[model samples]
Target: MNNKLISIALTGLLASTSISSAFGTNISIVGRIQAEYSGINIEGFSSQTTVNDPTFFSSWGIRAFEDLGNGFRVVTMIDFGFNTNGGSIGNREVFVGISKDSLGTLKFGRTHSPFADFAGGWTIDPFVYTTLQATGSGGTMIASANGLGSGSYSAVNSVVRFTSTTFNGFSFAVLLMPGDADKLEAHLGGHLGGHGNNIGDTGGENGEWDVQFAAKYVMDFQSHKLEVFGGYSRDNVSSAQKKITAFNLKTEEVGRIGGVWSYKNFSLQGQYDFISKALGAATCSDAAALGAIGDVSTRQCNTAMNPGGDGSIWYAGGQYRLGNATLIAQGGMTDANKTDVFASRKSKSFTVGGLYHMSKRTNLFGGYQHVDVIDKNSIVDRDRNTWTVGMRHLF
Candidate 1:
């Protein structure tokens, strides 16, 4: 089936390579794959050198567009991913949507949340969220791609994605994933991530629900670009709602704001996030029952405990093309989430690397990184240094 799609897409590409007409359709296949070895070390864990793709599984996808005249078009894409080391299919991305000169762009079927855009704009990006970079293995600064612990419990599966056409250097985008009582939210990389749902949120009978809303704006200048992003997500349960007995659950809410800047060969990005903890009578059950079933249970109005927290990250990076080689350097620090306890979480990472273009379709790259992590109580003060070399090919 994948081969057939690629074959048809290629045939389409060959049939309509020109685009001077107002009405036409074209298809293309695009993707990249890489291989590398990772030397990992944790606070007290054993160090190991493992070979695999650090950023993500190798994947490919087909993208097609059809011009419908009157400044409008239809766009569709689907990607299949597979692990390089294990050679097994992983996750996937699928979308089909339309765009217009005035209506903007909208697509459905499991897509990246608008917040995912914030993942790549500055130097820390592309790699900061990569599991191969400095503290990449720790998922330290990387929020859950599936919307698990994002913004306290904010964000929804952008199963429905929308992007506004650019106007005078400004553009906007949003995502919506509505569910029963519990809402779900997702973001980043156009991946099929996550959306939070309250337990037993079936229908609206219990008076419980969840919602996630996100938006982003990009400002383009003559020499650079700036993008602003913000989002909010929440889960609420009414006092009348109960699990096994009767009671109420604390409401959950999270908010985020930040942006990215790029000019010439330099780029910078940063963001701040806060989540309010789920606190209240907790459960309607007695202390013993609560103890037996846990502080959070399924009685009259019991819900999962929400540990609201705060996280901030920033990074600066640049590339200089010196003939066939592009020199790269990046340094950044993440103020870890510590909304509840002493919350003394912090991390710093520095890296230097180079990518040598072998041709239009391939590149050779190598780099080294230094990273440190400090937590509250300083229980685990793990530090690591990595040296890696790899190659990537685009097709």
Candidate 2:
């Protein structure tokens, strides 16, 4: 069939089907578009600014389901991402799965891990996925991307995922990804290379498994609510017999604890993470912004420069809603590995912002962030200030 004919057929099917019918198909189109005017100033460097969509924010997708007999349903999704500023379109999340009311939901495909989705993730951050988010930009969490052995991006690939039904305010989730065979090529760049492979050597992978596990609990009262969560994620990369790089990159591990409390018009949330062998995004960004490319070879944000050491990250924020607007304040710090290789990789950042509700599916948001990074080893101590004002619309 021609492309236009196929689209017409699908649209007709969607319009004719009864979404609530037990034996009929239900389909949904979902997405969001966001744009912002952003500016950044780095200490001792020229300022840069742009009017565009920030990273990982603009996307669109389709979700559909067919109800089967005996409480079973077939579900599927295909999502893609794009930059409003300038960049090639890319895949976001895609999956096929089955769900049952009493049993739970199980899926196989590429998507976010349990750690970054359910257990204790961006939910705690009011401005998640925005320029002021605490994960990749604020030094409050490990910025794991989808690589050969990585599993902590906003979405991951080749995953087997399961989430249990909530029972008495408790729920859990798990994700497993099998590693690929070693190409036998030397990886000298680092983790998350240009081709999304290992740029630097750290041995190679051979049928190893990466996993994530998480759980959450909730308590609700008439005007108050509370949610507590915890999770752990691991990226394995130590199966090959040959090790050929100096970056000493090993398996990455992260443990997180966090919760959110809401009472009437005020809400508070926070999270803390213990990270091993995974570089902090804030530290890496600071290095790159200061023109210290040598500090971060090949644009690998999660490279383990000091494989034997560990660090911690913590963030806290609160917001108050008044009529049509909400005010926000948040900040956090990342303490890098204590080894001499990263003795000065510590960073502290804070953000202040507000959101104005234009309607149920649209809002106006703006925020300012201040970040300071210390790198005694390279004598590159720098400070950065960023501000953004944007509007987001959902459909």
Candidate 3:
């Protein structure tokens, strides 16, 4: 049944691309394909390095738009990623937007948050989501109740976003999420009210409302270019919070800041993420105040009892380009000692690589990376070494 639906969808796209020309719509096919020999090495676990998957796979998208008289137009882009080695489509998305020359562009559908965009989406790190990330894969490897290898794609669904046209190299955007499994974050505490005057008087659960804001500026220094970016966001817990009888728990707030610089053929980039601020007041602990609002007591509401602390992750990288070849290196770390009872658990990784451009649409690359992870509970450390060489082509 699923295969049938997919075929219909692809056929629909092809049909639209063919007929849209009647309305003077410009449609284009765009994407890239990268094939590589990727391998990994670990201590104790004799998992030797092997060519598993490349840094990227073959994928293409269709984007179309038609000018509507004035400086306004209607646009739509549908894109997805697939594994050529396995013959499976992994990430798929579609978005429609209305753009005007004077105002800005408003897009509605599944899309990336402003944070991911400013950071370069899947390619945010030096190794481009392949390495140098928290759990690698651009930090997609998250530990959840489902398992320890949960892969979180970067795209967010049911989102409406607006990006202002650049003005004086300054641009800003706001992303509104209707909450459909896109990194929900719930904060505890209000600014003026609370069950027990916690962290500035805001105590109980802050609404399940989520919002994110991003701003950036690019400056030209004649000899070089500098771009600075910053983002702020508030999220609701997870499905667990919604299942917490009446009141699970939510984090307070989260934010990030970073910048990048480029001079001639050399560039540098880095960013820091401020993990959730578990500032919720455990109302269930003070039953007299929370009443049966907490209905059935659960660990989700035991925010205070849990490892409540602020966590942090940071990455720094630089690359140099000479002629048609480029060199890259980066280092990153994540510490959850403050938020997890298993305090002091941390991980760090380093990566270096080189890429040679064969043409405007093709490139050859090779790289190596190493990661060290410390498990607080087992007091055991795990290490991973990775290497890859691949070819990429764009159309």
Candidate 4:
């Protein structure tokens, strides 16, 4: 049954592409393919090795644009993500946007958040969307739950986002997500699972909204370049309106700041993420979180206890270009909210890697990461070590 449905959906997507092209819309296909050999060693578990794309680094998409004249254009992007090692195709980021030369762009549907765009995204994370990335896998950036707010790789759904035109290398982006879940949906937390068609994080069906906004400025000197960015994100739900009998679900709020400085062939980047009322899946296990070196499922803050929890994550990484190879080293820690009911779910990680640029669109990368995790229970405390070698090519 599922296979049949998937086949139908894929056919429809291809049909749409053909139909749109027939209407004089300019379309282009773009994406990348990444493959890696990964090995991991955990304190208690057996060492494991795999040839896979743990980061879902392989994807394809269609980008279409129709010139509306008068400096206006309509743009559409639909991306599909799949693991080269396994897993079926799934949606990555899908959105339609309107753009004007003088104004800006307004996007609707699932899209990247302001936090991922302006504040602390690829600019700060030298290895973003890769197996060695620091967002969810490395515990450097505090990720959101169910894509309700800003996360490194998660996209906001059912949202309206705007990006202003750059002026003097300064620009801003804003995102607004409306809650359309009812009481029943709120009880389920809107979308609890990782992926699929989810309306949006629960906003208690009350008059509440989720918002994220960020601004960035880039300054280039004769021999040095610097980029500064900051942003705030919030997911509000009325306690009185959506409170569950088992536990209190407070609002999730996040503040992010980061910057990058480059001189010659050397670059330094860092980001700090602060999260309050961190939410985690009730189904998360200590072993899973402890082993989340390159897994997004366990990338949340404090899952042992939600609501009222507060914590932060900070990352600092540097890159030095030596000929065609660039060396990378990054370290950061996640401090989960500590409480009497459970031990602090804190973890610290350091990653060292290098990328060999074979060409402008192809690179070979490898990295080693060590993580020390303190679980909610002392008995489950563990350490993780990971090594990966990968190659990626863009099309």
Candidate 5:
């Protein structure tokens, strides 16, 4: 009887140890690669250029999770971006979070905003070639004004966020950041109904804070699907002599509303943005205390401010599967408010692409995109195009 009791106790101890080891931890790695060719055309210029190169690269990520049990977990992910064109590694994302099935998830670090989730769902091009790329948020106008050679505004860094899991196909998310907390208590000031700019008047600090929120719903009925996403973002800038001298503007709010619908193999998506104190309007002189053409204009500045001078974008795309191959086509347009220096700039692009599946884990692809820009003022005219051929593998 004594031997049997000892044997049972040992079995129970071993079982408990195995369960603890199995439930306590997990890890994973993820990645992607891409390649492309690009070309550019400027209005009134006689050059149609070509950028043919082995561009785009594979990016990898390391992710881990710890199970706290009782419906709770701790998670972390780190991503490294590699340049196939330049042969280098880039740090992309680093974040940590605590998650509970019932309570939701809270994360801190650099991550894509809820706004990206709402705005990115409308296209068939994972690369956004034929449609406005996620980085094209400011589009051509802001790109030109800022002298940003390759115009794209896809992500923001240094954020704290909370996300709620899907509840009946509905969910919500919010992101926040502390602007120049050490210099001025602007977050507290905004909470107390004090003007954000006033908190740092007379050169206190010049950093800015951004807040964004989004809500989404996705419903499926057999072969048909519907998705609706909307978001708002506000950015407050501290008052400094540089800001006052550059744009005569201090703070801004930008809001977006959009949705997508799909049936069988076709989909359509649209989005509109209202910007307050538009950033495009602020202009700087090329040379001070002398006569020279400034980089941007005041008209562009005022247009950036007018709420009526908002921007709207729309796109429609379709895909048809043909025995291990899929043919894809998409077109999109962006209309900017005339009052916006960047608003008067308009663009339209179309693409035809295809994907060939080599197996469940590998694929080959190619696509062509043509883009045109319409300029209100002849001072700047930009027309660009690109072609991309790439392969992807998954494990």
Candidate 6:
């Protein structure tokens, strides 16, 4: 069948199957489109500004719930990524699950991990603001090992996820990914390029297993909201016989604590994170091994550079509502231990933005941001500034 026909058939099947059931089912379609223009200037460097490409700029989601007898239900959500500029499909999320008011929900498929969901709540001004752009430490840390990417803490492939229903304003979620441990060894050889000859010469199949877990709690009291979350992930690689292992198995743990206070039309919020060490194989062998001669050769070769280290991050922001318009401003920074190879970078950023409610499901927004980076190691000049203006529509 043609692509269009296939899509039509699948959608029809979903509708028919859902409607034919004894339980009543409801389906809702929703999504958003955001178009933005941004200008950036790095201190000591030239400045550039341009409109953002709308690819994946606009997306849609379909969520359906079947209400079974006695408070039981089946729920499924599929979100499609699309470009606003060209209107094309991007990546997509598909999942199926069973939910019960007292028992919670259990889902199996590709979905967001607990860690990613928690970060979305803790990170101030996410998707709505322009100043905060750090990718690492924000969400799922496990996906970084594989070429496969994750948003905050989302994971693809195969997963079993569980989310508990709120009990007195408190809830929790967990996700598990089951896979072969030997995959880690495969990456060591392919990416690091070694054959298990020396400590630095180990190649493919450095057997290792990957696992991640996260838990979170939220409480709402009158005018304030509190959230506490923690996440742990490990990637362990076993060295081949006769190979020198420079680093032991690697593990990372992340924790976050935050709160939000609201009064009248204004809200204030803050969050902090503590991260443990990260480990990875070296990129380059001895300088000489690459055909360089003399003192360069004497320099350390094939040495692993693990950027992981202890670090903390925090940010605070406030928003005030005025009729159809809302104003927002926030600032945050991250600090890492000097053991990190990527120099300890500190950022101070603030954003001033206003949102205009076009309608119940649509809004127009424009914002400006200023960011300054303080580099301790002189890795690069210590400054970056960004200015952005954007609009969003929801359905």
Error of 2 at 197 (Å): 6.9
In terms of TM-score, which candidate is stronger, 2 or 4?
4
- lDDT by residue for model 1 (203-316), tens: 122433444455667776797878777666454433323241211224545565666676765555555545453222210111101011221211111111223333444545
lDDT of 6 at 183: 32
- The TM-score values for the models, in the order shown, are 0.65, 0.82, 0.73, 0.83, 0.69, 0.68
Please give, for residues 150-250, the per-residue lDDT of candidate 4 as tens digits: 34335666789999988989999898877655531332232121222222334435656778888989998987989889888876754442455333456
lDDT digits (tens) for residues 1-395 of candidate 6 = 01111122122112212233344668776565566676656565567665642213355777788887798889887776554456554334578999999979888766644543443331434332122222221111122322121222123435677888877666666655554434323233322222222111211233333444555566667766565555554433334312434433244445555666666677777666555553432221221121111122111112222344455556677777787777777766656455623445454566666667776545566666555555565555335555666665554
Better of 1 and 4 by TM-score: 4
- Candidate 4 stretches greater than 4 Å from native: 1-22, 148-153, 183-204, 238-246, 281-307
Candidate 4: minimum summed lDDT over ten consecutive residues — where? 1-10
| TM-score computed on alpha carbons, candidate 5 | 0.69
Candidate 1 ranges beyond 4 A from true positions? 1-27, 101-103, 118-141, 147-158, 180-263, 266-306, 336-343
Instruction: Please list the residue runs of candidate 3 whose C-alpha ends up more than 4 Å from where it truly belongs after superposition.
Output: 1-20, 48-57, 119-126, 129-153, 180-207, 242-249, 277-309
lDDT comparing candidate 4 with the true structure: 0.63
Between the candidate structures 2 and 5, which one is better when assessed by TM-score? 2
Candidates by TM-score, descending order: 4, 2, 3, 5, 6, 1
Report, for every candidate in turn, its global Cα lDDT versus the true structure.
0.45, 0.61, 0.50, 0.63, 0.45, 0.46
Where's the lowest-lDDT run of ten residues in candidate 1? 282-291
Model 1 per-residue lDDT at 170: 56
> How high is the lDDT of residue 222 in model 3?
84
How much RMSD separates candidate 6 from the native structure?
Answer: 10.5
